[model samples]
Target: MAEFTVNATRFDPYKNFKFRVKWDGKYVAGISKVTSLKRTTEVVKHRHGGDPSTSRKSPGRTEFEAVTLSRGVTHDVEFERWANKVWNYGSGLGAETSLKDFRKDIIIEVYNEAGQLAQAYKVFRCWVSEFESLPELDANANAVAIQTIKLENEGWERDYSVAEPTEPSFVEP
Candidate 1:
């Protein structure tokens, strides 16, 4: 397994951000999320095995294997035009005074045993908050910060498809 970091910047609110993951030179998974945080670290796990207990006839033994393609990390993230304007007030305006809500979407994809796209999952998070003595732009920064942390801390995983070989025919002479 191999690990890699994806940096997201110059975000576009209408467009979705995507990240492709490969293992052992094969497409393993992909992730897409709305651009928000300055950076996000993604950890992916790849493995194969089965449980004997689940089967009527145990295989006698069970095998477990896993590879960590990446570790905990933080990458730089940039916000889209609308999101940036909503968060930062670099134009010398006072901080945001009222609380606001922001929504972010994330997508995860994984392949099946036949080397085909098997599954995809979509998740979302919302941020809301109120601040005192806060400028209009900064009022929601705290909410966004909290939402970002929650998403990163959450563990993400997806299982690959299982393929079985067909039996061959035998002819007697």
Candidate 2:
């Protein structure tokens, strides 16, 4: 004889491809790939002469990796305009200044099978840091043109206020 075990709660799986990206309160298009949505923190250590063998470790500064957004080149010049908001040449045409109206926060959402928000990554004070220049073209070749832009953000955090994606379970066709 054998006993079966199963949790009463249901679960749903989410795919990475099914994600939505929003910036400056607007949805951006032409995106093909995303990378480096990870963060790291520094640690500090302290110890006393009479203390135990180990030292005390405390969390220090947190650093967020620069996010890279890859996409195919398009007719839209939104990316360049977005970068100008961060630091653009002054109208005087010499010095560069930050545009008060340009900087904005970004949010990326992942959706589950039910089309529900699974996870959200909120990037604070995000700005376009770098965008690759136009790529070279050949006389005879068959391929899609693609470009990648990198973003430098002050900080980012997973909105734990939101629930995690549902767990995977049996589903009927």
Candidate 3:
């Protein structure tokens, strides 16, 4: 077992802008934004016959929320390739969706301002539930073209093995 150490000098939290998403042991490029990871559990309310007028609450099934990832549209086909695993457009009647090797495990890594890996999360059994290849094109608009993918995952947990790194201090010359 690895010992955990605290970085006492880190007064501020990690910034959200320095992060990356990886799958298949490789990083996906140009990921501009990612939705927050969330989960909800249902509460089961039950009452006993002997109880006067109060009901008891118990934990029920927990469901993980879908995460959406957005990136600038480019020639990279990573988004479209993963989306096709769910449902292909022109592939035959019954062979549209590829059942085997469809779901994948992904990692979201957060980096500190100094470009050090601060934290990471492992998302399990993720598959693209929704995908947007291209946003509405407007020649008049100056915004960049963007593509998105909504990933439905079974669950996600923090990777505790990634210990907090000791922040570096620089002296001015």
Candidate 4:
């Protein structure tokens, strides 16, 4: 495990645009957007018989929010293939779902301005819950065709192995 180090020179936070999503040890191509990672814990309230009105609260189950990834429609079928693993249409009655390898662990990496990997997260047991292969098309409208996939993951954790990077510096004479 890499020890955490603070980069005092880096005043500005990392830009959201410089990030990448990878699965199966390979980075997915052309991923334009990724929803924020979030988790919520259920609050459980309990009150004793003699206790006053207010109930004591405690944390219960925690759920990881679904993450949506969007990109311009292209020849790349990584999103479509993962979505199909959950439910494939026209693939016959008993063969609709690929149970053996449906879920995948994915990595989301954020890079600093100098293109150095600054942070990384490991999302576990993710399976596509929804997929949109193509947006509505119109001859009069001009826009890139976008596709999307919503992934439901069991949990995620920050990869502490990725230490803080040393920001690059330029010298001026």
Q: All models: lDDT?
A: 0.31, 0.74, 0.95, 0.94
Cα-based lDDT at residue 152, candidate 1: 25
Cα lDDT tens digits, model 2, 68-169, are 877778887777777666666664654465666556788988877667787788998777778774666777978778776688888987776666545566
Please tell me which predicted candidate would have the highest lDDT against the true structure.
3
Per-residue lDDT tens digits for candidate 3, residues 1-173, read 66888777678988899999999999999999999989999999999999989999999999999999999999999999999999999999998999997899999999999999999999999999999999999989999999999999999999989989888899999
Those runs of model 2 whose alpha carbons end farther than 4 Å from true positions after fitting are: 1-13, 87-91, 136-141, 160-173
TM-scores for all predictions: 0.25, 0.75, 0.96, 0.95
Task: Candidate 1: list runs displaced more than 4 Å.
Answer: 1-86, 89-101, 113-115, 126-173
Measured by C-alpha RMSD in angstroms, how accurate is candidate 1? 19.6
Better candidate by lDDT, 1 or 4: 4
> Which segments of candidate 3 are over 4 A away from where they belong?
1-3
Q: What is the overall TM-score of model 3 with all chains considered together?
A: 0.96
- Model 1 scores a TM of 0.25
* Model 4 agreement with the true structure over 54-76: per-residue lDDT tens digits: 89999999999999999999999
lDDT of 4 at 26: 100
Predictions: Cα RMSD each = 19.6, 6.5, 1.2, 1.2
